[model samples]
Every structure is written in C-alpha cells, then in structure tokens.
Target: MNDTTTFKQSLTINLRVIGALLMREIITRYGRHNLGFLWLFLEPMMFTLGVTAIWSYTHANHLGSTLPIAAFTLTGYSTILLWRNMPTRCVSAVIPNLGLMYHRNVVLLDIFVSRIVLEVTAVTASFSTLGILFFSSGLMKAPEDIVPVLIGWMMLAWFGASMSLFVGALGARSEVIEKIWHPISYLTFPLSGAAFMLEWLPAPARAVLIWMPTVNCCEIIRQGFFGPMVHAHYDMSYVAIFNTCLMLLGLAQVRLVAERIAPQ
Candidate 1:
C-alpha cells in the first residue's frame, strides 16, 4: 500500500480506538441507572450551587468585589473543576485500567485522552448549564465578550489535559505523586484565581501570581464574563507557551510509560 493509504488506515484505527475508549469510559463511570451520565455535570453543578448559596447567604465579600455572587461563584468554581478534576481522575489511573493494555490498539495515551475528554466535557456542561439557569432566573448577567471566554477555556482545557497526562504517567512510576497531588490541589485552589479576581491581589502578589497558567486562564475567562464590571489580568502568550511546553513534556512522559508497560 502507498504511504497515503497506510496513513489513512492508521488514522482510522486510532480514531476508532479513541471512540471506543470514550464510550467505555462513559459507561464505566456513569453506568446506565438514574441520571447516569447526567450526574457527571450535575455533581459539579450542585457543588457550585451550594458554594454560591453559602456565599450569597453569608454576604461573603469576595475580595470586596461587586460582581454578581452567583455568576462569580459559577465561573470560578467551574473553572476550578475544569483544571482540578482532570488531574484528579488521571492520577493512579493506569493501574486500574491495566487490563485494557492487553489490546493491541489500546495505548496509555488513549486512556489519558479518554479521561481528560470526559472531565472537560462534564465540567464545560456544568458551567454552561448553570450559567444559562442563572441568567434566565435573573441571578446573573450574560458574559459581555465570548471570544476571550472561549480562548481562555480552551487554554485551561489544554493545561488540564497536559497536566493530567504528565501526572498520570508519573503516577505509574511512583506512588508519591498520588499522595502529594491531593493536598497540592486543595492548596492551589484558592490561589488559582477562582476565589478572587487577579485585580484584587496586591500589586506585588499580582505580579508574581500572573505566572501561573491557571490564574491567567481565570483572568481571561472573567474578562469575557464580567467585562467592565471587573478588571481581568492575563497573558495569553504566556499561557500558550506554558501549556505547549507542558504538553510536550506530558506526551514524552506518556511515551516513556507506554514503552515500559508494553515495549515496542
């Protein structure tokens, strides 16, 4: 067969493999019972809702900002779930699915990709659903500019996927990753720009915190969301560069883990 034909066949096989894995992941995670996959987004939505309620009830001044509490909480918590859940699901993931490694086409990358896609889809859905419900019920206003929101969300997804791959691969090598990641995730949440706007930070803190990709992502998303009502700080170029490098590292690590698991 010619190179073109061979490439096409390989591409087709890989796509089929990914599709199968995605379906399997959904079924395995959500099951076929009540709400099944619906729970995927609903779980996060409910969590966000509870937090929003608490914030609203307590009159918690989020960094002394005047943004709508519900909208602010939704955007922030959803963003957290987007970046946080992927890595949480990925760490120590390979061992549980080692049985699938027996399949010729099933590779470590496929597993990671499946989990990442599942998480990104669930969180995005939750974010959108809550945003619409809030807007309709007069709890929050619609985003002023969607362009930055899309760009920012895509960037955050990229970051989450890459980090999950890297963490998942490393977890295969050592148990330490799984242990340390839990606390690290919790500690980082507050600083992730989800709880407060970057503009709320002191000038010194803002200067330093902007380097975090998640923070930049939050800034971009909120800029799209609250517009003039809030001042969002971000650097897309930095976010792009950081995510790209992390992706490269993640892919490289996954390759190494794959080779070790099933040598080519």
Candidate 2:
C-alpha cells in the first residue's frame, strides 16, 4: 500500500473509533447515574458557584481596575479548573478503566478522547448555562473579540490532554505518580491561573506567570469573555507550540507504557 494511502486509511479508522468511544463514554457514564447528564452540567455550576462565592467575599473590594467580579472570576476560574482537571482525570482513567481496554481496539487515544469528551461535555453544560444566565441578567455586557479566546481554549484543552496523557502513561508503570499527586496539586495552585488574574498579579510575578502556557489559556479565554476590562496578556502561539510538543511526547509515552502494562 502507498504510504500516503495507508496513513489516510489509518486516520479514517482512528476517527471512527474516536467517535464510537465518545458515544460509549457519554452513554455509560451518564446513563449509570440517575442524575445522568445532569451531573455533567451541574459539576461545573457547583464548582463555579463555590469558587465565585469564596472569591467574591475576599476580593469584593478589589475589582482589578475596571473588570467586573462575575465576568473576571467566571472565565478565570473555569479555565483554570479546565486545564487542571485534564491531567488529574486522565491519570485516573488508565487504572480504573483498564478493564475496557481488554479489547485490542481500545488504545491510548481512546482514553484521551474519552476524557476530552467528558471534560468538554461538563464545560459545555456549565459554561453554557453560566453565559446564558449571566448575560441575560446583564452581568456581562459583550465580548470585544472571540477568535483569540477560541484559540486559547483549544490550545489549553490540547495542553491539558497531552500533559495528562503523558503523566497517565508514566503512572501506569511506575505507580509512584499517584502517590505525589496530592502534593503536586497543592503546589500547583499558586501557579494555576485560578488564584490570580494577569491584571491582578504584581508586575514581576505576572511577567513570570506569562511564561507558563496554562496561564495563557486562562488569560486569553478571560479576555475573550471580559475584553479589555479583565486586563489579560496571552500568547496563543506560545501555547500552541507547547501543546504540540506535549501531545507528541504523551503519544510516545502511551505506546511505551502499553507495552509494559497488561490490561487488567
């Protein structure tokens, strides 16, 4: 077979499998619970609500120049959680769901795609409800631009997925990764885009933070929702480049891990 033709066929087959896995995950995950799909939407809402309440109480007086509390907190908090959850969930996916991979068809991509699908579903339900409720009530006016925001979201998602896959693959073999995860998570908060916005951070700290690709994800996404008021500085290209590298690394790691890890 021609190499090009073979590659195309492989791609096609992969797409078919991905689509099937997404459907399967959605049905099985939500179907098992009585609340079912409601949980998907509710997870984000409750998460957002809890964060918003805590922040509003502490940062009530500090609006960060001209940014509104609701708009700033929503985008920043949601995007932060989005990136953070990817790796955490992905790491857990392998061990817990190993039984499903007994079939040859369930590859690493299946796990990655499944996690991404569920994450997207949760975010969609949450952010969609949030936007509608907030906008309808006149909480946020309108976005100045949406293109950069979208680019940021896609990059962040890719970053999260890639990083998670890499770590998950490592965890599959060593089994040591899961042990440090609690400390890793705790140490992650300061650097995470959730705790502070680009505008609010001190000049030096903000400059340092801009180097972190995850920060760009939240910053650009927040800018998309809040515009100039939130005061965000992001480099989408930076995130895109890092995400590409991470994804490749993760893909390679997954294959390696699979060779050593027999499906349970």
Please list the residue runs of candidate 2 whose C-alpha ends up more than 4 Å from where it truly belongs after superposition: 1-13, 23-33, 57-59
Tens-digit lDDT string for candidate 1 (1-264): 999999999989988988898888888889999888788888999999999999999998876788899988987899999999999999988888888998888888989988898899999999999999999999998899999999999999999999999999999888899999999999998789889887887999999999999999989899998889888888999999999999999999999998887532
lDDT of 2 by residue, 133-156 (tens): 777888776667878767777787
For residue 149, model 1's alpha carbon misses the true position, in angstroms, by 0.7
TM accuracy, model 2: 0.86
lDDT of 2: 0.75
lDDT of 1 at 38: 84
Number of colliding residue pairs in model 2: 0
Cα-lDDT of candidate 1? 0.90
